[model samples]
Target: MWSMLMRKFRRFPVFSLDKRQWMKNVIHQEVGKGKRVIMFYVDIVKLTEVENRYGDVIAKRVLHIFERILPHVSRQVFEIRGNILAIQKLWGDDFAIYVSFGGDVNEEDCRMLSIHFQEQAEKQLNRQVSFVNREELRVHIGYAAISGQDIVKEMYTSVKRAAHMAKYGITSETYTHVTQFHQVLAEENVTMNFMPIVHLPDGETLGWEALARGPEGSPFATPSMLFRYAEETDTVFRLEHICRKRALEQLRYVKPQQKLFINLDPRAIDDPFLLRGEVFARFEQYGLNPYNIVFEITERHAISNYAVFRKIIEEYRKKGYLIAVDDAGAGYSSLESITEIYPDFIKLDMSLIRNVDVDPIKQALLETIVQFAEKVGCKIIAEGIETGRELETLIEVGVTYGQGYFLGKPDKGMGHASGQAMNFLRTMQEKKASVREEPFLFTPAMSEILAKTITVEKHVKVRRVHEIFEQNQRIESVVVLEEGRPVGLVMRFALYQVLGGQYGIALYYERPVSQIMNANPLIVTKDDKLDEVARRAMTRDAYHLYDVVIITGVEGEYIGIVTVQSLLDKMASIKLEMASSANPLTGLPGNVQIERELNKRIKQQVSQMVIYCDLDRFKWFNDRYGFETGDQIIVRTANLLKEAVMRCGSGDDFIGHIGGDDFILITKAAGADELISFLLEAFPLFFADIYEKRGLGEGAILSMSMAGVCMIPGLYENVEAIAERAAYVKKRAKELPGTVFLDERDCAADETHQTQV
Candidate 1:
């Protein structure tokens, strides 16, 4: 029959091999062509269970039956390998009969063909009498017609996913016959809506949570209904993809500082379609600060596979989008999720805060959750707050942030109910200012000038500056020069050695200048800035070997020593410089102080790391916890830093305040991680204890999240450049499930697997 068909159509396309191989190649090539190619991916339902129950021989026999029955129904086109049979039907099956009438088939025809194939295949399998299969056998079919390599790749993934859904359906006895992929697609109706989570206290609007509405105008508006249908119909992935795309689109319309919370299923992140770079491109086109968009991951479902999901989340987070563990404190592994994902914010489940004030158990639960959040560096956002009593109770419990209808409803447009947040910020700032007073930035040029010229003859006992040392015992070393040249250093050790040793008075009175005087004095120019001179002087190594850098003329004329005491005075002046520019919520300098420090650093040409530290949800914490508790949080954070510096950092590192909850740090790159780690470990201790003392249960503790960006030489235009990058990363960290994000020029430099002490 094959030879006759080939000879009669000699002028037409000819097959080079047997019917099966020829059909396989033809199908493979046809699917490869055109803007869109229909994909029909088929898999046996419960094949694993069938094989285990009936053995491999029975499975082979079933496959053999399929091989023999193909030719009777298929107008053999092509096949890929032995497993997949690609066929263009001329007759027998109704779907194949319809395919013969094709001139670029429409979607309606495609659907009909898919349905027709399932019906014919089922009937054919049922008729086979030789094998009385104990359990009815059916094929789960998935199909997608798409164009472009990207779409094709996505189609391939979707088809495989559809196959799994179909197989799962079959196992449930719901889908007994061959299932068409379009059946699943038909059930998905992508829609979007919004709900607002408002701030309490002053009743200001902060942001809206984007909600997913299933099917046009359906009563099943809750997210559960939408997702349940998706799981039932094998369309969850598609529905999630559509909703995410819509949420990103809606972000453009949201008010510029207000955040938009998008609820996401953990499974949604695993979708290959959503992971494309084009999705991010669309987000960027919407003018969204990915950081401002919060992804709410519900903890209701068991997260069995977190490795891949976590990788996807980390990538998205690095780009600036924030992750929120929603309905936390209610899920089985809520605390575990908090630790694993390190979310920027944990939204307390309504169940935990429903009646926190009256119920000590609920209060204790909330408090524990809040404390856990603090320990992990996550901020708490109380959800489902509906009454004034609840609000007052939350405030008393020291909840960091609150979100509920009682606070504000989610709206379609921007511009929140006013006067609340602004007034609150103003009041807080005033209080902050009252507590902190600015310090004077005393420059050496501005300090009282001391002028004296005392010449030392060749063998003279040069103890002439004993009075200077007596005035300042902090002075560690002094320089001795000869004819406009640095020749020796007079260290405290040298003076004490001579005074107590065997050669005591003999050396002090008779020793020549070269013989007794210590050679190789550290020297500096008169023009060297005070900070630079101070930095060198503070080093014990510099003091012992060559304490000071001698000031010189063009001809190397000896000037004076850059003593350690002078450096200490210089540091004190810089601190005063910082105090002058601060915002009082924190003793740290404000943005203005940052500018000055950056100016000084750039002018001095010193290697420094510009650390931008921001307290995550500090404003909300203040609002809920009262200004006093908030102040304590700030004070505790400052003390943690001071202690951290005392324990881990050398004197060379400079930690400055950038005001409120923001801070600045200038230090060697090597110290960045250590300092950050120390603060991270130490902060929770102080935060927890303060909250405990305030009777904020055990959970309402204060915590901080930070972004530490390394200053790349020439990459930074000014301090603002470093500050901006650091701030951006800190924002990103606050959005993550954790409290600290250290942006060391490149985030990758902070290895994910490596633990830092």
Candidate 2:
């Protein structure tokens, strides 16, 4: 009789009606006052279908179970009704709860609460509703934290969007994709790999591009698959957020002054976390400055509104973050984006860079883009360079930077170009230097020649100085200093001579050495050239010629002492190396020397002009004339070129005989044009004399064609690319009649010049 009475009263209301209106008003008021609110949107998976299949009794029982358990999840829980317009459109079949927090709230607490409520609801619903071959009822929970004032609509939309994404796993056919995405989120499985963007000319790394990767062997293992699935499921914002966080975390190991490139999807820009200071804060946590970060705005998807996008990019720029327009030339929209935004870096699409070495059309297109970038004052980074030829071609075409398998593959750590990439760079650099004929000049400074020596104060006891000479048999001299300035020199033989005499120790052993010190010694600054110092040492009196040379700084502070033997040794070594590297016929520096000079200039960050000079019709002249006569002509031309350089260029300017009719000259950029013009005028006069002496016809006279390339050291990676460009300009010069000078300083300049032979 009790069981029958309870069944009759089972239909009575067990919970209060949904108070969505009251909850909405409360959320609005709290949000308006800048209080933090968290909204948990909970949806019963296929609830309507479950109700139809299992009857009203079971559906009502499932709702009653959620109402009883939600109070345990949070003290500020409120039931959401369908009356609120924003919540109604987004909530759909999902039941919503508003949880407000005062002061502070832990994100982990909210996550645990959502999980507990979902599990409890599922357990109760599964027990009450069952059928043949029926799927178990489950709950999908989505939550978002909202702060600041008057964003109730945005708050609801964000939570509702998250819920819809959470529910997609149950309703969509690709359940595995959804499940894997959630697992990644829970486990934080997203990670980043870095690929180096190297300066192609020198193989120096400019920066690394951070590439995102998901868990291995999963459907979302690759960035393309992962982002595509996220976009389809409306979880792109969350995925991008996780990716950015991981990228920033991995940047801790990056070297100082090296840039870090991080990709950002335009659609994810609206995320509150991204818009607020969260991303900047994360960077700060990793000790990364905003100036070192470059936000690569990827163009994989269309940007719906460029105005809004530009505004966001401008905001980031104002905070010292750089912007790069990625995948340029991939589509018209990317071009439009770059034009509208004027990014700091424009990355060329790999499609255009592929096989560029063999395809003239691709080269032309790349050349055009490089010109455009130069005009806009943006650097061009060629992407996907996979071969040596492609890298060489890019460098030849004046691309400032590049990244691809040819340089380095993406790895889990900061890596540099290796294997084939390093070998290719070295090989090209060597090839560029193969034409030089003179040994490179290496002048050792006083610092390198100085020998570490013992010094004594001017007032030291004579007995102690005598003991020092006796302790070290090889000691020739000791420096006496007043403070840090060298004032006197004490010779070991002189001290020994005075101290070895009878009664010498008793007479003067305890006195200060200032009485016996020479008070005059050879002193040279550290900046003094080795050769000059050696000459000064040789000019000393025969007895004192072997005395140590005291070295000092600019302020006259004693540094160390140098022996005559070390100076002679260094000078000998330099002479031997120079002799071995000089060209036999021209007696000038060769390839090895030229490369060393170029590297030194680059290291010193000097601005210089490199000129490639070739004699037109040299091969014909050599073939027609005897070998000896041809050699004579080559020698004569070298002499005239050297004369012109010495007359018009600085003493530090370099001249090299690159074998045969080719020569190289490195000089200051300001005087390079004048030097070339002088050579153009001087060479003909010498040729005229040779022609008159040999009784040769006008056909026998060959004119000189010079290609001059002006460069600043940091602007290029290596000398090979500069050499290649000079060769190209030389080829263009050969096309014109008579001796012509071609200027390829502006890479985009048209090929036309008016110069006489």
Per-candidate TM vs. native? Answer: 0.44, 0.47
**Which lDDT value does model 1 have at 77?**
23
Q: What tens-digit string does per-residue lDDT give for candidate 1 at 496-553?
A: 5444433344434434433344443445666555655554444322114234445665
Candidate 2, residues 613-683, lDDT tens digits: the string is 89988888788767887898889987777676656776567788888899988888877777887887877
- State each model's CA lDDT, in order: 0.56, 0.72
Error of 1 at 638 (Å): 35
lDDT at residue 61 of model 1 (Cα atoms): 69
Candidate 2 steric clashes: 12
